[model samples]
Target: LAKTKPIKRFNSPLRKAAALFKELHANNGSKIIARSTTQDRMTKSAEYFLAGFFGLEWPTNVTLLLAIEDSTGVWNNSLAGYYNCNNSNNYRSAGGNNATIEWYETYLADATARLQKLAPGFGWTPKDSYDAQSLCAYETVAYGYSQFCGLFTYEEWQGYEYSIDIQFAGNNAFQSPTGRAVGIGYVQEVLARLQHHTIDSPIAQINVTLDNNTATFPLDQSLNFDFSHDTNIMSILTAFGFTQFAQFLPSDRIVPHELVVSHLEPFAARLDIEIINAPAPVKASRNNTDLYEEGKATKYIHFILNQRTIPLHRSFPDCEERDDGWCELDIFLAVQSKSFEISQYDWACNGDYEAVPYGEVTNGVPTQTSS
Candidate 1:
């Protein structure tokens, strides 16, 4: 079954994270010059944004949101967009002579050991100062990309730290601050333990206890889990209650199938998903499969949720039809109309689904507000 090769397209991990945030902005200081303050910026081109794909889709969230705003932030001329770039033919970094040019420090040591074993089973909380072989980048300023924290778990929250900026223009002060826990990627002790289980007490019977405004479903009600994108993905969506909820759909009523199980992914860094158990692509069979009576199924909205048990492995019993081994493990998320307290730039979801102005949700904490 030896096939796995497909990686090259300027070699990717986002072209080595756009050549390591453009060679850490070429060893320091002033290149700053962004302006974008929102305005449909580029107008779609590049062949109408490449019309869907298995080919030519490498924008890696628009080059990691312009590499967190130009190697380190600034430029919102109402949103012309700018997050650092030198892209030598597509991503060049220190200009490359190539000897392993820091390729994002080996992808920040595999994105910091999968952010420390899948962030404490998806509720995060670990950070003895980051090290599963740590190396995460980004922490800029001049008004672009200086976010520094809470990207999925890990939350020190002070505009999320790590904004080194070599000297002011917008975020102020610089020239060797070297702060942000030594050049960003502070890992804020990875977070996500959003256990609001709404106190039915016994942890809600079979472990159902989610509340940021409720969610402990088996389908009979309760469901709006976005705890502003954290608190452990709102406690694993209050214990796994959605295979779909991208908010404002834009494609077919939006349904997709495929649910093959038996994973636990490569076990150290995990992540080997995608179910639909094969009316097509098969192989990997997670230890000979049967992940609950053979995987693969589709048409989501099913429940029994418990997500991220160290990538534990085994789940398919919950059923709702299409059980050829259950499929639909694509997971999904697209919400960028712009908000995040008015700057992380609403995550740019040009893909579809709605909810981009993320301001209001107060008590629940979706507050990116303050603009």
Candidate 2:
């Protein structure tokens, strides 16, 4: 679950999520799978949610799985794929793709130029701008409000928010050809879990197991929770081909106001995929001579982003459209399986990329060209 910081104001959403989880799986004997990044804030977020679930003060009995290592260039954890493949052309030194940095420079030029006069002796580079923006969010969440929040005018904060939007778009979405590639490993693992099967990718080498027998990797669990940085979430969304967020920059002068990161990966942004069983729709055979009914009921999958239901604009084959973003379970699995089959993890991440962009190869097919 994407959540805000562990502050009191953010407690309601976590409580609501806990209540929903309990309501759905309380008696099913399904285990709660909790995983998070190594960062303290993320760990604390998980702890707060667990407290809400068990109604305990500390909830120390609840085991929180720490998945990512706090090291550089570590590919062991798929959840930290962007950091693992840090040198990929998909990112800039300040972070994000070349275009993202360009946008940051263009949009923040006025604000940054005035920073020395406004804040006095405050020199701002692209990285400084990024860090200041991050500080604003961090301090606000930690203390209910932040002193740094007052340093910038409302217009400057808007520019800072845009800076983050471009960064996410260029490095974690389809706008950059390599964006989806960084997410393929996690996608493979998700597909494996859905099938109750083991993943064969290099991500399996990290000691994270999905054998259906391990307590941490039980296949029968109805709810699986993973906590990580916003980069991973954005990457997964891109890998799944959610084109609604695939925003491209037409020119350096234009700012994508619609593509805001505060809404996408705010303090507590949660993306929930729900699997539900509903009556199957009856359909006539291709010949129109006979009726076809496979069973009384079928499973459908729907997505919830930040408590809002987002309809699928594109999905697997044979998936019937619904206003509530529901797709056939079988079709969803098939689509994910196809993605797994096409994803050559090792080759894409480590092999020769002289002819193609990193993370663009799927089953030997190139989804994008080298630029």
Candidate 3:
């Protein structure tokens, strides 16, 4: 259970969210909406977050809604979208694993030789070194520490991080065929809330039963909380047209880029989308010191992931550059309105199109095959 896990106590950001909510005076617990998958880990995470947000008796204050995480293809769960995406389950989705393997062979060659020389006849291969790196991460989470961590240098640890980044890029980000398809559901739901309307039809992977109703899918909620996996979060970022993460991650080398999955979706990652009200339109400061503009725009949208502000103009050209990293709320909604069509969810998930080779697609949307 997350309650008993030592890592849960170390999640300061989750607790920080609760503190921010309190500071904002958002104390009407009944107005809060908390959603998570039926998976035990996610459910427990939601419970822990709510316990901090509301109180120890969170159940009475706010309902914890659970979406199904089954693979039967009978249900649509935005919180667990990969299950509803059949293409995401097939061998084609192994592009990430394959990319990681290619990178492992390249980066771990020296480490394998050095480690094997330390113990001549143990038959240590690159795979063994990779396994040691994996153990370093897992054992740290499971047992709080691992002897395997000190075996690698800082550069090797960086290689390990890049390997994971390549995996996420291929498996769940722009490099995967179903990347946008699996995330379009949540994207559309967020759009509905921003546009102030209930989803009229099942256009993507959304649960129509919940979305079509106003009770479970309220459009006027002041705060919305949803729990999801790291892969889904990566795909969600892609589906939202965050092109900053669209760069192709090469297995041969770690290039300079901002698609680092560890920073983006490490365990207990949080993405906060804030709607700010400004009395006048704001502009960038001349000296880059956060000086206020003469007038304030009526509203602006701010996206903070893992406590880092994502500059909206960096991804969406429609969003004007601002010093505060906020985009006009209306422009942000407009950019998202076109994201559904760009995702090509219907064809990407269910079409008979031939699969594009790995590394060819880097925009989270598959190309149209020639007739």
Q: Higher-TM-score candidate among 1 and 2?
A: 2
Model 2 off-target regions past 4 Å?
1-23, 27-31, 57-62, 68-75, 83-97, 118-134, 147-153, 200-213, 255-258, 282-295, 315-318, 341-344, 352-371
**What stretches of model 1 exceed 4 Å from their correct place?**
1-38, 42-285, 289-371
Enumerate residue pairs that collide in model 3.
280-295, 280-296, 280-297, 281-295, 281-296, 281-297
User: Clashes in model 2: which pairs?
Assistant: 3-268, 4-267, 4-268, 342-363
Return whichever of 2 and 3 wins on lDDT.
3
Q: What is candidate 2's lDDT per residue for 154-201, written digit by digit as tens?
A: 776766667667667655665444456567666766666666776433
Candidate 2 Cα deviation (angstroms), residue 21: 4.6
Clashes of each: 66, 4, 6
Instruction: Please provide, for model 3 over 25-104, each residue's C-alpha lDDT reduced to its tens digit, 9 standing for 90 to 100.
Output: 34344555578988899999999998986679877767677888888878789887888777777765667888899999
Query: Candidate 1, residues 1-371: lDDT per residue as tens digits?
Result: 00112121356578774654453334233222111112232223222332231125434312211111132323211111112111111211111112111222322443456565745755332332232112223233233343343342442221112211100101100110110111111011011111122323221111212212222221111111111111112222212222222122111111131111112111111211221223333333446553333444322222222233222122222332343333333331111111122221122111122221211121111122323
Off by over 4 Å in 3: 1-31, 117-123, 286-297
- Candidate topping lDDT: 3
Give candidate 2's whole-model lDDT: 0.58
In terms of TM-score, the best-performing candidate is 3
Whole-model Cα lDDT per candidate? 0.22, 0.58, 0.81
* Lowest summed lDDT window (length 10), candidate 2: 1-10
